[model samples]
Target: MSQPHLSSEATDPASAALPLRRVLPAFAVDVALAATLSFSTLMLGLFGWAVWRGIQLAQQHGGAPDAHALQAQIGTPPVLFLIVTTLVSTGGTALLLYVWRRRATAAERRESTRRLGKPSTWGWALAAGGVTFLFSSLMSAGGRALGLDLQPSNLDLIREGFARFPVFLTLFAVVLAPLYEELLFRRVLFGRLWRAGWPVLGLVLSSVVFALVHELPGLNGKPADSTLFLILVYAGMGAIFAWVYRRTGTLWAPIAAHILNNAIALAVLQIYGDAPA
Candidate 1:
């Protein structure tokens, strides 16, 4: 499921005519796949830990660990949980992508090769990343001007998580998250909707959902007053990703852009050490 380098076909009418319904993964299938992955990760991670603890306890005292002991162990040494969950999620996503690609139609395979064979695909992806940074910065500045505290509430959680498990959090942010996210938001939501002849609706709906998912967690420990502004900012970034995908005619375009954007954020977090994202 690969296409030849047809660099000039980036804007070809035939490329636009590719049957996305036949090429793109079904929305319902993606949703079900995501749910299955999530459930599997949780079950496997927790069950594995429980069994290990039980074995250790049995060996030590000829009985399983008590509930309190299990609870204490779960959080005291979190390395096992973190590693297991990360491996499951990342590996599962990769396997799913491989399966989908293997099952793709010839037209589906061609979707990514139209313009992506040239260096210009990376150029467009990087441009999208840059635009997203500028747009988000401006949105934050404007919110402050309007007397809204638009600080990202997830920053503290991210910092804490990184402190506890740097490798897992970094991998999740810079790679795994972007892969499935771009697939769902850009490819499934926006691309499918646009291909179904609803470009405007696709753009707006996908952006809005993307924004909500990114910003809603902030509500857990912060004021809800800035939620609207933060959502708008993130939605704008999502829109930029969608725009790049549309412009480049490949899902990889947005995936690359998203990864770049997150990698930049990770770098800033590293350099600034406890600074807010």
Candidate 2:
């Protein structure tokens, strides 16, 4: 009896090269759908809050509220929108992977899970805290040398939000973040790139894209100095995360590391209320 030949679809090259034309379109469609749903949800939530507050103010004072106060309240929508977008994008990506690609077999995923040795959770958490502190300090020094302002304004926001919603903040920072980020950045994008036979280029490209997605240009149609500094920092962090994932061949390690880093930042911000200059 002759051995059977493997099917073309089962071949590595054919499996990997799933045509950018088809892949890109599907990816774009999913992202657009996610954005639309997230934006709608954000708008409804913001509108409801605004209406509630307006009614409360009217009941108390029997007149319209101060213009500045109203504006400040309205200003919160954009930030909320960003948070919603992050959640929806991450969730949508995971759904897409499950429904479409079926990228890794069950066995492969199980093996990947097993590869992530059971390191002490607290040790990882402490190590991640040290890493974040050292990296942030180094980045801040570089920014200062370059005449750039790299303030910890985002850290302040995280601290304030955590104080207000401690349990929710913990869930978001520790669980949702690591799971979604690892799935999107490591399993989906990086895995695809690596299989395409350009591991190094793929790593850098994905990291750059990750950083760029977080950036927002200035109101006057110019990029902010702080934004540039943040992009560099985020990109470097992405590369580090990618390395961790690749080395372990398991998403758990990177996810744990990321959660630890964010949790540490939250702790520091709460304790120190932003690092001193």
Candidate 3:
């Protein structure tokens, strides 16, 4: 039978090593998609401000805006920017997913099916989330030990944005974001690299890229040192998610952990943030 040849091909070390050019999105599409999402986010920020300003103008009968409205709108920019980007990125992520699914190799499909059938695959996601949470906490502590203060950049801005628009921002963070991010970082990019015979390399690369994209810049809570440590913290979480994805061979594991992590963060922020006197 032909089974022997198939077994040898699977076992042969040389067969696992493919040409570097084979990893298209792994080397190219991932970066392109990231850049596209960033550009769209920036453009949406400007567009949202323009649209809001027009609405304010109409409400104010062409006079100067009320002080309260102006104050509230202070946080509108970032919130609107993310909300719009969520919508735009959702479509982009979906398209990428479709393309990858259609083009996936038979081996990859079989592996995915096998992983999906395992009961323990998804159960590991909860443990992964807990581990990542500990990792994030450790990174934060380490940053503090190094005298860096190390709060997220624009932490207050994000909080205020949530205060101004809680529902949409919450949905974006806890739901839309995890889905979109998992699709790009774990599903399309990691899966592509996995199928391309660079699973370990893919794990590290996707995690680093994920962290880089989310490292909020330009406004730290304290200014003791650079953002290198913060990047490590974010990267740690990304690595955990990537590990979950790898173990399960399905996007659901990492996606669930991501949502849990974000949901916990959002809840903590809402619950423990500054209280009124």
Highest TM-score model number: 3
- Per-residue lDDT of model 2, residues 113-154, tens digit only: 456444643354346546755786688777878877666445
lDDT (tens digit, per residue) of candidate 3 on 1-277: 1110000001112456567777754457666766676567667656777678757765776765676765555444556665566557554654554464424445655555666667797689788876776677666766677777566654665586688888877787778777777766776666566657787887788777776666645544334244667777777788888888867666777877888777777777788772110
Model 2 clash pairs are: none
Per residue, candidate 1 scores C-alpha lDDT tens digits across 92-120 of: 65446445622334565576675678688
**Residue 156 lDDT (model 2):** 46
lDDT of 1 at 257: 88
List per-candidate RMSD values in Å.
5.2, 7.7, 7.5
Instruction: Compute the lDDT of residue 92 as modeled in candidate 3.
Output: 61
- lDDT score for residue 141 of model 2: 74
Query: Number of the top candidate by lDDT?
Result: 1
Runs of candidate 3 exceeding 4 Å displacement: 1-14, 21-26, 51-81, 90-114, 165-167, 216-225, 274-277
Ranking by TM-score: 3, 1, 2
